[model samples]
Target: MGAVTGDQTVDQTVVVAVDGGGSKTDAVAVRLDGSVVSRARAGGSSPQIEGLTRSVEVVDALVREVAGVAPLAGVDLFLSGLDFPAEEEAYRQAIADLPWAPGALLDNDLFAVLRAGTSAEAAVAVICGTGINAVGLGHGGTRVRFPAVGAISGDWGGGGGLGSEALWHAARHVDGRGPATALTEGICRVLDVPSVPELIADLHFGRRSQGDLRLLAPEVFRASDAGDAVAGALVDRQADEVAALVTACVRRLDLAGEPFPVVLGGSVLQAGHRRLEDRIAARVHDVAPHAELHHLRVPPVVGAVLRALERAGADGGALARAEAELVGTAHAALVGGVAR
Candidate 1:
């Protein structure tokens, strides 16, 4: 949405871009001169997890902070948990009355991953953070995506899922219901518990929390590195799931024979775990032998800036400057300032 205050054309050069995720929301105000004037962060703004009203409040607060006194020429929002067009529309309507309405562009955060991973406007992006989702954009505006609404949408493999799988294997191993493996000790040690039974009981009786369980995901990778068979298997399964998603998107976009970028985001993939990376690369090569892999090292919010630059009619020089400047400064904004 474009905004004009009174007779003067507001500096349409200033852009407010946001990358809203399940855990946090990052907002930035970039001047047309290629400087990031302000950057702020807030809590989760995913309507699915935080509810519509709360999600709007969180986004509004962060955007308001970064925007400061500037009248935004463009506002680009790439968010997670907006699975359908309806959810996007709901969010659009909710923010329609804000000062930066008509010039706003809202999209799935997967697209942000696409932009963050490569300079191309069209590509495939897969996020394997808390959950797994993929998006593929082809030439001439062709688009393909999954619902990514969790198990009900035939989706699996994320940090949360991996953590739960580790616990499942650990509990079964302890009770003699499955193959015994190092995960029994590894998981218990990671959780600082005596045994799988006690850990399970703590989680079940509210002594521990699901968030604690989710933190076990990185431990799963570590255990895999240590040659824990159960952890290795779980990691292999995650690699399989990510590969399946990336390949499916490639096939859907019919880019099987071409050299296209497969941008990987989220902690699971970006962590650069060699075992998982090798398996995913092998599977992807099997499907699209020429597919390129881009592991995102910069914050995904860079995508929002890229999109905003495009919207602001920024020249190649300005675009390059924004990318270089934003890449350096956005990290400072990512720390703290998560709104309650």
Candidate 2:
């Protein structure tokens, strides 16, 4: 949608880039010059799990939030995390059916972020927050993914899995099946509960449990830093898993070229845990010796914005400006804004 000034026309032909993650949705709408126009967020409504109606509603809410601040009635959307073709179609149809329709283009979020960072067709990118997913892109727009199987079953990347592992260690220690460490104490302190039994109870009752469990990840990291064997091993194991993911993507896809560009993102890596990230990077190299791992710090939304701009053909001076504006927004306008 293009921006409206109480007129039929919008402020300018713009590109609206959106990044929807499991935790939150962040969007940035910009004009040709890339100056900051409007930014907003809404609840996560990925149709993968969230029904079509709910998914569109959350996106609409965020779109409207931005539209209220600035118009997006005429912009093209470059949305991320829309991988499964079925899921993508549901979202595409919903957007097309909308009266506010601003030509929306959808693809896996990793593509948007990858393009935002560089022009590599053979690159691997990762997201390590609430959940973790990896993508391998080859020449002529080919991609491979290490699927996110979801919690209780998801692979050992992302905050949720790591947090769950932290809790698992604590429980096992009590059951006499694992070695003792400061993690049990750390978990108890972080949860603000007298004991594990009470913590489990808190999670079972009220509006607790599932979401708050990931809150223990940071505490686990802290204990590991202080030389807690249990915590350190857990962290190291997860890092290895992340490495394996990228390596598998490459081997499975048969990326015959020299090392592809590998990028990493997610709460687990970006959470001010440089030591953990460094360890993971090291492990990644060991697993996929040929790949060059890029320690990127760019926000995913900037990637989304870049894709949107390209889609809208609002390039040249306008593209440069819009990209610059959107990058600024990625840095300051939104919270936890990763590559779209």
C-alpha RMSD by candidate, in order: 5.7, 4.7
lDDT of 1 by residue, 161-280 (tens): 988888899888888899887777877788888888998889899998776766788989998899888899999999999898988888788889888788889988989899999999
State the weakest 10-residue window (summed lDDT) of model 2.
Answer: 331-340
lDDT of 2 by residue, 171-266 (tens): 778778888978888888887878776676676786466767778888878988898988888788777777777777777767635766777766
> lDDT of each structure?
0.81, 0.67
Q: Which residue runs does candidate 2 get wrong by more than 4 Å?
A: 1-11, 48-51, 68-83, 151-154, 205-207, 256-259, 272-275, 287-290, 328-340
TM-score of each predicted structure versus truth: 0.89, 0.83
Give lDDT: candidate 1, residue 239: 91
Measured with C-alpha atoms, the lDDT of residue 127 in candidate 1 is: 92
